[model samples]
Target: MEKGTFQDVNAQVVQRCREGDNRAQYELYKLYSKAMFNVSMRITNDYAESEDVLQEAFISAFKNLHSYKAEASFGSWLKRIVINASVNAVRKRRSELVPLEDRIAGDIPDEEYDDDTEWQVEQVRRAIQRLPDGYRVVLSLYLLEGFDHAEIGEVLGISESTSKSQYSRARKKLLEIMKDTHSMA
Candidate 1:
């Protein structure tokens, strides 16, 4: 099916779900659960917790379906809920106390890496998994999830500047991890 046709069918399913159709709800879940689960996992970094978050997010989305205007795609709306649930799960697990000084740092140069080095997807994913929670969340939201720094700041409850700084630091750290792994290989 063409991308547009697929989206149209999804929109119909979403409408049916809003009207409380169980089968349509299940169809929506089938279409989106894997991607949403990945989003939850990246944020929470625990398979069990990701599963919990994913379930809660879907429930929340279904309950609040009436409020979902088509301003964004259904997947985008669902992703926002998953991200919120995952972040809340992380907060419940541990307090993320980034120092004020760290958040206030002046504009750091965006690190440039050597274009000659080839990196594997598995290596990159593992490196991302190893990042600190603050860096990982910002990086994942901005790079993988297609959120701008401003949107990330809104979702994460940080200033836009802080979001940018965290993303910059995450990129540098990811590169370092990749290089180290490459050398050891």
Candidate 2:
């Protein structure tokens, strides 16, 4: 993710957006929509909702373009908006947020995770999509989005300990899913 480059490269484009240039808005949207849509999809696990989230995120970004202080890369800034919007969409669809299940069974050795089982991206992606919302979001944020435990905690409104435990469970669940899929295949 050449994210930092966008801060330097997209400066002119962002300025035009701030000044109400429709073409600039379009350009920004064009540049970000696919990646942002993927972010939405990972959270919502529904195509139409991801599309809706992407559109809403772009509109919000354009409307609030002035608030983008250029402290972070434009892509980073936009990604944060997309992530929040996607999470909100998921929350709305589920009547209630499923807080991460905190029960870790004993005797599940940590050494199991260290085994080198090769995994394809698509294989893991399908597995992730099948996870429950709480696990999927935590897993995606920590692994794919490069969010640390503290950042994930902040984003999901949980403590850092909760975030770490949630990620651990999510990783275990993801591996189980992959193994099941492989065995079935």
Candidate 3:
């Protein structure tokens, strides 16, 4: 579907939701739940925790639907909520969001290139899950979720430079994990 078409349908559903339509709310939830759950899972890295975060994010999004204002697509708006809730869940479990500030930004690696295109999606996913919380969150936000460094910084409450360096490190770690697994297999 075209982006504009979905946005049009979403606007109408959002309007109905703003009027307290339960079915419309359910429609929106059904439309977004799976993707949002993945968002939560990528950050929290725990199935049960991701489920809980998904439910909490939906409830919060519904309650705050009035504030949505259609400035962005409903999915984008809901995604921001899911990401924030997921980050919070991680923070609550870990006690803080230390941005792995040990290394200076100068240590951040440049993007690496690989000609091999044989990696399985599951392999990459497992590798991401193995990352430390700080690295995983930054990597997920910057890579999987399409948040730029500045946006990731805002969402993760770290400096933009920190987000960049953390992502570089995460990418490096992910490649190491994948390489080790391939060698073992």
lDDT by residue for model 3 (93-172), tens: 77754443331224333343363443376567767777888899999888789899999989888899999999999999
lDDT tens digits by residue: candidate 1, 64-180: 999999899999899999999998887776665644244324423334445534335555776787777778889989988999999999998999999999999999998998889
Off by over 4 Å in 3: 1-3, 96-119
Q: Per-model C-alpha lDDT, please?
A: 0.84, 0.82, 0.85
Give candidate 1 regions above 4 Å deviation: 96-119
Alpha carbon deviation, residue 39, candidate 3 (Å): 1.2
Model 2: lDDT of residue 126: 67
Error of 2 at 97 (Å): 9.3
Per-residue alpha-carbon lDDT of model 2 for 1-185, expressed as tens digits? 58656565589899988888899998888888899998888787777888999999999999898899988888899999999998887777666544323211231232323334433655676678778888889888988889999998988889999999999999899889989999997
lDDT of 3: 0.85
User: Considering lDDT, which of the candidate structures 2 and 3 is the better prediction for this target?
Assistant: 3
The runs of at least 3 residues in candidate 2 whose Cα sits more than 4 Å from the true structure, single-residue gaps closed, are 1-9, 96-119
For residue 63, model 1's alpha carbon misses the true position, in angstroms, by 0.6
Residue pairs with clashing backbones, model 2? none
Best candidate according to TM-score: 3
